[model samples]
Target: MVDTMKAAVFQGEGRLEFEERPIPQIERADHVIVEVGAVGICGTDLHALKVPPGTLSRIPTGVIMGHEIAGRVAEVGEDVLSVKPGDHVLVDQNAPCGMCEMCRRGRPNYCISIRNVPGFPGAPNTYGLFQDGGLAKYVRVRELNVIRIDRSVPIWQAAVAEPIGVGLHGLRKVNVRVGETAVVLGAGPIGLVVTALLKRSGVGQLIVVEPLELRRQAALACGATAVINPKEADTVERVLAETNGTGADIVAEAVGWTLDTCIQVASNGARIILYGESELDDVIPIAPTLIGIKELEIYGVFLAPFVFESARSILESGTLPLDQIVSHRLPLEKVHEGLDALRDGRALKVVIHPNEF
Candidate 1:
């Protein structure tokens, strides 16, 4: 094995550099060293880079930034038993102390000891931010953080397991039955995954509200029965019109910029799933009176949790065209191209092959 490998290192706000880095080794009994095969560009990665300086103190400059990861096990510590070298795997984004209150309660995404963890502080303990992630030739992760995957699946599709798991987690928690209306706000990668999942679940009518023309078309291809351009039409009125004036039975808020669109389109007793993420301190307007009158049920989805297995199942089922969502592939040196494409709405999902460059 090479003593050093190349990595795309984050150089503070709006900057990323490809440089030589030492290949990580298993330093702990539960640690595993993986040869990163593919890593997907996520909105969160772009958000951190695009945020105002000093806003994301948790993500220090030079932390190799990427979360959606898939790799092959190169080495495993003596205590690692579930996986072996040469196993294909997907790295769980978060690493929680099993004894923490949140982990004990089955919600490790909110681990209370995140700040005390060795890497990044302030946010939950996650790869890319706190530790060197898969935007490199190799990544060092704990054994428990790696999930063994079917080798039959393409590495790029496996890399997206994290985001797909998030979409499945929220869908499993929501109440979307067959022959019902579902409204999805935002047509990004996650939104498209949710749309595909809803369609496979037999959603009778699926409407997507998106301002981007390409994403609106992608949503329709992903199974949305109707696509409304929020810039041209009234989103709420159009949604209500499609639902015959009542409203959608399920509304997935995949855009965290605002809650108004979801709130405005929800029907009486509808389940509104807050699936997207906002800035740590961002706030949106909400009405308590409307919540009471409409009797809306809101669900918050954080990390992938126990849904990675289900996500793999969905991917293997082949119901969703995972390939269509991945629009570009770039070497590590040109990662900025992928990031720019995602930020400018020119691509849906971009995979980075660190080994290539």
Candidate 2:
């Protein structure tokens, strides 16, 4: 095997440099080396690349940045027995310290050690964000972070499992009921994935609110019964009309900046899941009394903690419109272009093939 590999290193805010680095070897008995096949450009990556950087600015400079990853196991440590070499696997980026209070309480997503906190002394344990991730030909991951998948699953498709798992986790939190009205406040990747999962859960009317016509069409393909263009009409009015003036039973604020609209269009006792991550410094004005008066339950979703296996099963079923979700597939060298496409609102899920380049 080659000794050096080309990796996309995060130099600083708005700087992602491709440089040759030594291929990682198993330094510990629990380490596993993977030959990365595909890495999906997530919204977090864009956040990390922002001019002043978003919440992910805590990522130390020089770390490779790609979390949504899938690849073949090239080598395994002596102590790793869960997966053998040549196994197809999905990388669970959020590796929480199992000994943390939150982790012991079964909420590893909020593990204090790796959780994103301003000025927190502890470094994040997440891959791509704080460690060398799969944005290169190879990456070294702990065995605990690797989940083996069927060999028949396409690497590009497997790379999207993280987002799908995120959607699953959010949906599970809300516990969508059959024949209910659901509204997704964006048709971005997470929005679309949630929309598809909502449909599978038997929602009667799945409404998607998106300004982009292309995504609206994509939402429909993902089983959205109705779509509203917020730019053309009042989103709240349209959503209420679709629900016969009662509003949505479940609302997903997947656009980050549309929490107000999600609140405005939610029916009494509606459950709203905040799946989008906006700028950390950004805020929206909302009347707290409105939530109390409506008895709405609001939930904030973060990283996928325990839903990777479910996501793997869903992907292996080949039911979701994977093509609709994955809008672009580019090589590693064109990572900048992929980021640009996502930033320009021209793509949904962009998968980068590091080895193919």
Top model number, TM-score: 2
Using Cα atoms with residue i matched to residue i, what is each candidate's TM-score against the true structure? 0.93, 0.97
Which ten-residue region of model 1 has the weakest summed lDDT? Answer: 113-122
Candidate 2 C-alpha error for residue 5, in Å: 0.6
Cα-based lDDT for every prediction: 0.83, 0.90
In the range 1-357, model 2's lDDT, one tens digit per residue, is 679999999999689999999999989999999999999998888878888788645578999999999999999999999999989999998888889778899998888767877865555768888988989999999999999999888889999999999999898988888999999998999999999999999999999999998899999999999999988999878987888999999999898888888889999999999998777778888867879999999999888989999999998998888898899999999999999999898998899999751
Superposed model 1: Cα runs more than 4 Å off: 51-57, 113-124
Estimate, for each residue in 1-357, the C-alpha lDDT of model 1 and write its tens digit.
669888888887668788799989779999999888899998778767764733433477878888898889999999999999999888987888888667799877768644433343535557887678889889999988898887888888888898888888888887579998999999899999899889988999999998998888889889999999989999989998999999988899898865777877888988888887776677887776777799988899877788888877766666788876788888877788898888788999899987531
Candidate 1 clashing pairs?
none
